[model samples]
Target: MEEERNTYLDELSGDGCRIGGYPIFVQYGPRENEELRTFDTLLLQLDCEYECDLMFGDGGIANFFINEEDLKKLDFTKVLYNWDCC
Candidate 1:
């Protein structure tokens, strides 16, 4: 028998990828600059050798940045990184 499970993917959406324990959602905009890019793509955009920083925000929801540096620093893998892309 298969038990039912409802994850963040199940809660928010079913279009993103999961890394460690965090649910990630991606949306590529129609405009050239607004489009979402891959690691290498963003690297080229910033022209940096180190890891880049990404943040997301909205109206009255507060702002937040997603950084693997913090994750690696704290050695945590279950914390949530909720970014509303709507």
Candidate 2:
């Protein structure tokens, strides 16, 4: 039974994907220049160890899975780079 369950989960995670929970989407205003500002807002609301897939273009969208352990080790400041100024 455990083996079957594991196999099912593996199948579900195919190509680095899983089908559970809803994604959190965030959009920044045109006037906002800092990327971290939006990131910080989203990061604070999420728990650690949460799985997140982010997409940014005209706007920013983040899909996070709650995981408390992962949240503790995340360094948002270092991760969100400022390429325009750099």
Candidate 3:
């Protein structure tokens, strides 16, 4: 029997909040276990304008915003590196 690949996002309240017009959900994955993962980082572009909020394990709340210029210069694959180096 194949073990079911568990997915997060099944535990958040139905009406938590909306980010960049997409509803935020609690997501769990190998990379991010038991955390909130937005549908698209693009939503971070909305920033404070939208109500999307991320609560880090350290209890840090980060409001993300990505403008056209920021997006153009962003390397999605190296997000962790950027975060670490910055």
Candidate 4:
């Protein structure tokens, strides 16, 4: 059996990150009209005003989306990086 993806904010609410009441996604695919595809990661559809006011607008840049105020706000302990430093 396949394991479930607990990659949603609701699934991660226990960590204390503000969970947007609406559904967010960890979607993967190429951007519209581009050849080099952007990779997928946990992302929030953000309001253009940057209020954290819960009004979601166009999808924000992944880094900006995960940021609160000016500090970085993700717990990467569960994430694995297999890149070679060569």
lDDT of 2 by residue, 1-86 (tens): 99998988766432232233432334432214553234332222221222453324433332333233334665433333221100
| Best candidate according to lDDT | 2
Select the stronger candidate by lDDT from 3 and 4: 3
lDDT (CA) per prediction: 0.29, 0.34, 0.31, 0.29
Model 3: lDDT equals 0.31
Candidate 2 residues lying further than 4 Å off, grouped into runs, are: 13-86
Please provide, for model 4 over 1-86, each residue's C-alpha lDDT reduced to its tens digit, 9 standing for 90 to 100.
12344565436432222223332333432232253222223233332244564322343222122223222445433321111111
With candidate 1 superimposed using the best TM-score fit, by how many Å does residue 29's alpha carbon deviate from the native? 6.9
Which residue pairs clash within candidate 2? 48-67, 48-68, 48-71, 49-67, 49-70, 49-71
Which candidate, 1 or 2, has the higher TM-score?
A: 1
> What would you estimate as the lDDT of candidate 1?
0.29
Candidate 4 versus the native: TM-score? 0.19
Which residue pairs show backbone clashes in model 3? 8-28, 9-26, 45-66
Instruction: Tell me which of candidates 1 and 3 scores higher on lDDT.
Output: 3
Angstrom error at residue 29, model 4: 4.6
